[model samples]
Target: MNKSEMIDAIAARTDLSKVASAKALDAVIETIVESVAQGEAVTLVGFGSFKASERAAREGKNPKTGAKILIPQTIVPKFAAGATFKARVAGKDE
Candidate 1:
């Protein structure tokens, strides 16, 4: 679901107002982003982990012209779901 819908869900579950929920959600997202951008891993038990990963430079072809190009290396955010999150997605009755 989208951010508003997620805020609604959080409000319903926690008795928080929509505004408070939004602030909380935003805070969480900002924290995670800042941490990952600083090359730190953030993990929540039974949920997932987020971190920055390095991507090596590689050669690629332009789709339209098929011209060879060098793709520069970079660091990108990555996520890995924890076992419990994976299990729930897979419909395990745990």
Candidate 2:
């Protein structure tokens, strides 16, 4: 679901107003982003963990031109779902 729909769900589940739910969601998102950007990990027990990961430089082919190119190394955000979340998504209960 989109942000608006997610906000509605949060409001419904927490008895919060839509505005309040939106702010809460925004705060959570901002916190996660800031933490990952600073090379930290944020973990939600039953959800997932977010962290920054390094990718090594590699050679790649350009699809359009079929030319070889060097892909630079970079740090990127990564997420690994928690056990509970994985179980739930797989239609099983933890």
Candidate 3:
């Protein structure tokens, strides 16, 4: 769901006003983004972990031109779901 829809759901579930729920969601998103940008991992039990992974430079094929291209190495954000989160998504547990 989109941010506004998520805010509404959170507000109703927590008995919080929409404004407060929005603020809380914003803070959570901002905190996660900032932490990941700093090359740090953030983990919430029963949820998941966010971290950065390295991509080594490699050769790639340019599909459009059928040519060789050099793919620059970089750090990319990655997420790994916790056991509980994975189970919930797989319909094994909640």
Candidate 4:
């Protein structure tokens, strides 16, 4: 669901109002982004972990021209779902 829909869900599931829920969600997202950008990992049990990963430089072809190009190395964000989350998504968890 989108942000407003998610905010509605959070508000329904908690005592917080929509404004508070939105702020909380925004805070959480900002914190995760900041942590990963700083080369730190953030883990939420039964959910997932977010971290920064290195990508090596590689050669790639331009799709339109079919010309070879060097893709520069970079740091990218990564996420690995927790086992419980995986199980739930796979319908193996109650």
Candidate 5:
């Protein structure tokens, strides 16, 4: 669901007001983003982990012109779902 919908869910599940839920969600998201951007990994049990991964330079073709180009190496964010999350999504009992 979208952010607004998620905020609503959080507000309903907890006794938090919508504004408080939204701020809490924003803080969580900001923390995760900052950690990942700083080359640090963030892990939450029963959820997932976020980290930076290196991508090697490679040759690629431009789709429109079919021209060969060198793709520069970069560090990109990646997520690995925790076993519990995977299991839940797969409809299997943990």
Candidate 6:
């Protein structure tokens, strides 16, 4: 679901107002972003881990022109679902 819908759901579950839920979500997102930017991982026991991965420079072909190109290496954010999260998505509880 989208942010607003998520806020609604959280409000329904937690007795929080939409505004408060929005702030809560925003704070969580900000914290994650900040931690990742600083090269740290964020792990929620039953959810997942958020971390960064490095990509090596590689040669690639241009789809349209079929020309060779050098793709620059970069660091990218990644998420690996934990056991509980995987179970929940698979319709099982861990």
Which ten contiguous residues of candidate 5 have the minimum total lDDT? 85-94
In model 5, residue pairs whose N, Cα or C atoms come closer than 3 Å (at least 3 residues apart or on different chains), thus clashing, are: none
Across 1-94, the per-residue lDDT of candidate 2 in tens digits comes to: 9999999999999989999999999999999999999999999999999999999999999999999999999999999999999999999994
Q: Which candidate is the best by lDDT?
A: 4
Which digits, one per residue and each the tens of the lDDT, describe model 3 over residues 1-94? 9999999999999988999999999999999999999999999999999998898999999999999999999999999999998998899993
Query: What's the C-alpha lDDT at position 50 in model 1?
Result: 98
lDDT (Cα, tens digit) per residue for candidate 5, span 4-91: 9999999999999999999999999999999999999999999999999999999999999999999999999999999999999999
What local distance difference test score does each model get? 0.96, 0.97, 0.95, 0.98, 0.97, 0.94
- Which stretches of candidate 5 lie above 4 Å from their native place? none
Question: Over the stretch 1-94, how does candidate 1's per-residue lDDT look in tens digits?
Answer: 9999999999999988999999999999999999999999999998999999999999999999999999999999999999999999999946
| Candidate 3 Cα errors over 4 Å, as ranges | none
Candidates 2 and 6 compared: the better one by TM-score is: 2
lDDT of 5 at 8: 100
Indicate the residue-level lDDT of 17 in model 1: 97
Q: Encode model 4's per-residue lDDT on 1-94: one tens digit a residue.
A: 9999999999999999999999999999999999999989999999999999999999999999999999999999999999999999999997
Candidate 1 regions with alpha-carbon error over 4 angstroms: none
Please give the clash total of every predicted structure, in order: 0, 0, 0, 0, 0, 0
Positional deviation of residue 80's Cα in model 2 after best superposition, in angstroms: 0.3
True-structure RMSD, every candidate: 0.7, 1.0, 1.1, 0.6, 0.8, 1.1
